[model samples]
Target chain A: MAGKDDDVKVLGVVVSPFAIRVRIALNIKGVSYEYVEEDIFNKSELLLTSNPVHKKVPVLIHGGKPISESLVIVQYVDEVWAAAPSVLPADPYDRAVARFWAAYVDNNVSTVLYTVLAMAMSPKLFDEQLLMFPGMAGVLFAATEEERAAKAEETLAALAQLEKAFAECAGGKAFFGGDSIGYVDLALGSNLHWFEALRRLFGVALLDAGKTPLLAAWAKRFVEAEAAKGVVPDAGVAVELGKKLQARAAAASTAA
Target chain B: MAGKDDDVKVLGVVVSPFAIRVRIALNIKGVSYEYVEEDIFNKSELLLTSNPVHKKVPVLIHGGKPISESLVIVQYVDEVWAAAPSVLPADPYDRAVARFWAAYVDNNVSTVLYTVLAMAMSPKLFDEQLLMFPGMAGVLFAATEEERAAKAEETLAALAQLEKAFAECAGGKAFFGGDSIGYVDLALGSNLHWFEALRRLFGVALLDAGKTPLLAAWAKRFVEAEAAKGVVPDAGVAVELGKKLQARAAAASTAA
Candidate 1:
């Protein structure tokens, strides 16, 4: 096992909201780490070896041992740092609630949004490939125009649920857990930048201010927060990247 | 908010492995609690109000405040009890690993098994109804005989992964997290009761001793462990319940 003095490195991609989760966690905990960008389309050798299971981004390598899965990494950061502004609540019940919602964000918000984006950018990939995989596969498939519209409507419904949660969970606080941004906040907030880009790229409105005022405000506060400002990828960069991926996917399908 | 002195009530079903999770948690913690079995077909007002989102069983009512989701409830029990034998490891990486596997068990093992079971008992429920829902819905679906057999093969493959995990993660320990049964253990262990019934009901072996000796051994040890005694529902009971549910579902479908 590597010693305590060993390095801390994060393998990530700017477009991936999951990677942003780790970046935000590290930033909030005030822990310094090397952030290495990975080409998700063609994963690096290090990423492949580091996270052999998912082979996905947001792998945090601390002292040579890599930890994958964004929430798992976030929890690890909170525990290892063991500092103030704890990511999860000190109370067990509170922590349970926090964990539930974070899982909810992953299940309801993140995965669904990714499916929607995949449908828009790479419909063939969405229907023929990604849908067949296990766990949240092809959940929001859009094989037809009507199907696409239905999925878009579903996204709005999902956002409405989150908006309801913000009203109920926040209870007059600025953040979900009160005072400062906590676990659920980071879990959801970290994805907002990339989600914003998706919104613009797809010409869809998910979290409309009129529909979800609280969530709209919360997203603004989260992205603009001092800790998150420099860490999160800019929306413009995200939009450009999305367009590039779209063009490339189209070309790949055409060539095939 | 209810005070600390309020009653601890667990709303669960006798056959649900998730309810077993809460039972094991409370049993391990040595916390006194009342168990209220819910009629899932007609959820109680209390259960519905407690967990308005899922309306599922395994709702932990502590001091009248309800906490839904089994894993969340288990974590809460470990934290509130906060005594000897920590539910997860102290090391951040270890905890992350445990969390990941626990999530994996939920994502892969539990969901897949439930889908298979639903397919067997109520094909209509599994197809038209469950398929319509979002988030972990219609995943692991098998409409035809060939599809079901393939899914069974997939289940075996999933168990093999768990067996591999036991070897890699445990490093010759009796449990996943080491000396005592930890978070991941409970995450998978609690399901053994329901799984046992499924094995007998479906006439398939997921944790075959010849194939996954480690997992097979772990299942025996988990069910027979003194802490798990009486907390986990009996396989006999589960089988009976499964049969009754299948009959009822068949009758309902015929009526429709």
Candidate 2:
């Protein structure tokens, strides 16, 4: 239960990995908050007012003040709830390494997912509107299955890099932060369901055991972790959603 | 005056704003270190060894441990120094706000500069290679003066958003972190010279007094700050460099 003064609310969408990251961080910290699922298309006034700059979800409204961006929110959670079980590592160097990997995951791995997911989630917008925004078009648009496959290869390459990063950061431990689920784990793990969904949709094995053995094992442990309970979506649901969106996009394209 | 155990070295290029960020942060903290300017075209083994993943600079090597990425290095500086003159805000919410804006500058603002700069700095790479990287192409490849002008308008708009952010964060103070320079200041201020060069090269006033008055004033003050003495470059040198690069690119195109 949230206290009167320490009220926390999360403006998010169920399928968003970014939103899921905030939930996982809050869940790990054991900080209770009200979750308000947003219609990303027709965003709420609160979401708009809260995150005016980005106007996107996973906004953590703590004590009436809104903090947008999932990574920023997770760090905010770590700082505000400064007790045991810290999300980031305690040492300065370790902390920097965690931040580096977290960012790398966002820039390299997450962008690929967003490209495909953006198409799946908002096919009409992907087809019609994204053309206007060239920068976003590069990020969110994949014209063909060929392009998607190429992007998938990039994702695999990124995962391989993360595999080495995990070996270095984890150092024969369970997770990137070592012995416990930490910032890097949360950053990459939140997208595990989507990674699975991508595999189901396009036959792209992002976390292939053959390629990234450590990361593949880490993924399994991460999804099974107590903090991930109810926070991470089931892969099947994500796949079904992807299929539905794909069908809609095909119909829209045909009409156009 | 560096001690044996606490040796610090920065592998960077003079023109890089990202590298300059590390210098500014280190200079402010009064940390004495070696500056190894890397030839980005023919990157040294040391630079490659230090930051094998990205292999780009502003790689801060502390006591033989290497940390890549400018923002990450700055944070590491703050954490390790742990003095009164902190780069990041001590308050959790304020820190979150600062980090959000810093990232906003990197994602929204620095990107435009990088696009223009990449073309100016590496004309051969731009002409020969960048076509294959479509994602980078959208960000870096602007064929005409028209596209560059459009990007300039986008930069001006970003500056306007940042002007409001400064008002909120500074609350009538000198810098984004308050009276003293902080994280957001270093993040954005590091690019002041490059911004000037962009203006000189394209006749686009990014920090137009008419549009973003507060930011224009902030930029002036930031450049004059004591910590920025030798860290920030002279706009004349950057402008000259841009001109030279432009000429070479034009000559290369004509010959082709």
Candidate 3:
């Protein structure tokens, strides 16, 4: 067991939004921790040992015991330092709603964002690969030109729902939970940075300022917020990295 | 706004484990709620209007306002009651761990269980469908002789991780949280009835009592616990339903 007296430590890759989630949460709560950047391509022994199961970055170590998973770490940090700026709702029901949306973003929105980015950056290769995958391939790489058009319609429908959810949740508020950013905001806000970069790169807006004004405003406010100012990665860097990742994925598809 | 004095009502389908999650949480909290079983085939106007977005069941209506999603509802029930049998841990870190596992089950295990059951009941049809959804299809269709011989190694490897997680979290305890059942148990225990039936139906023994004695014991102890007795659906009924659902799914695949 890690001793309580030892300094808190966070292990993460520099550019991952997942890692940013923990950093934002910890910073908001005013908890100071040592940040150890890991090269995911060549993982350090400490990172590997700390999160042996997932072998993923964004491992939080307090004392010596480690906790993996960004959302899990956020909840752990909230509990361990309850007196500070609370991230979760004090009421259980509200907390559940907060958690539910957070989970929804992780499961649904993330995948959509990934697919959209893949399609935008390398339309030809993405289409070819989609024909190979079973479930999503049909929808992602429709056989007939008509089928492709229909699939795009379906994709838009799903995106619209997500945009609506953001509007309803963040209506007239600086954050999802209202004026002060909460866990839900931190979770959702981290993704928005990447989406903003993707939108810039792709030149097709999913979360238009006009269509989802609240979400757009919330993103701006969140990025400008005191807690987020210095911690979040630069949008330009993320866009450049996303383009490289997309190009690499396209290359891999061609090779296969 | 609905007054606090009005009776709480839950709109959901009768046999859904998701709906039962809310029921169990509410019952444990000793909160009185009117159960309105919805015909999923013919969703009510209230159900449609209240949960306009998802239009799903297990909508918790309090003071006229509706809250959707079972996990979200459970949290709402916990908040409204705020006393009696507490479903979540008092400490935030432990509560986060419970939520993490619960979310894991919601996002992954439940989907896997569904896929496994679909495969067991209709191997041929499932194989054909697997051709369409390659990523997950490999696991489902691998039950066949030629495929099983090739894929069983990977399947077992994945299952082992789940077994290890269960052992680490719930071993030597009546439930995952020690002494008594908590959120993890309730979130997970509701699904055990379905899995138990699947075990008898498939006869493959995924939850081998010898291999995962703690999980087996926890399942037994959980379903028998006072919180679970009235809340969970009958195992016998679940077995019958499982057979029918499998048959229907198989037939549907054949028709397609």
CA lDDT, candidate 2, residue A196: 82
User: How much is B130 displaced in model 3, in angstroms?
Assistant: 5.6
**Model 2 segments beyond 4 Å from truth?**
A1-5, A112-141, A241-256, B1-5, B112-141, B244-256
Clashing pairs in 2: none
Return whichever of 1 and 2 wins on DockQ: 2
Model 1, stretches more than 4 Å misplaced?
A: A1-6, A112-141, A240-256, B1-6, B112-141, B240-256
By TM-score: ranked, best first: 2, 1, 3
Can you write out model 2's per-residue Cα lDDT over B99-159, one digit (the tens) per residue? 9999888866764334343454456544543322221122223457675666666667778
Provide the TM-score for each candidate, comma-separated: 0.85, 0.88, 0.79
Predicted structure with the largest lDDT when compared to the true one: 2
Chain B TM-score of candidate 2 stands at 0.85
Q: Give one digit per residue, the lDDT tens place, for model 3 in A146-234.
A: 75455444434545665666566656666777678887787767765566665576443545677666676777888888887777787
Clashing residue pairs in candidate 1, if any?
A: none
- What lDDT is reached at residue A144 by model 1? 44
Count of clashing residue pairs in every prediction: 0, 0, 5
DockQ of each: 0.47, 0.47, 0.32
* lDDT, candidate 3, at A70: 85
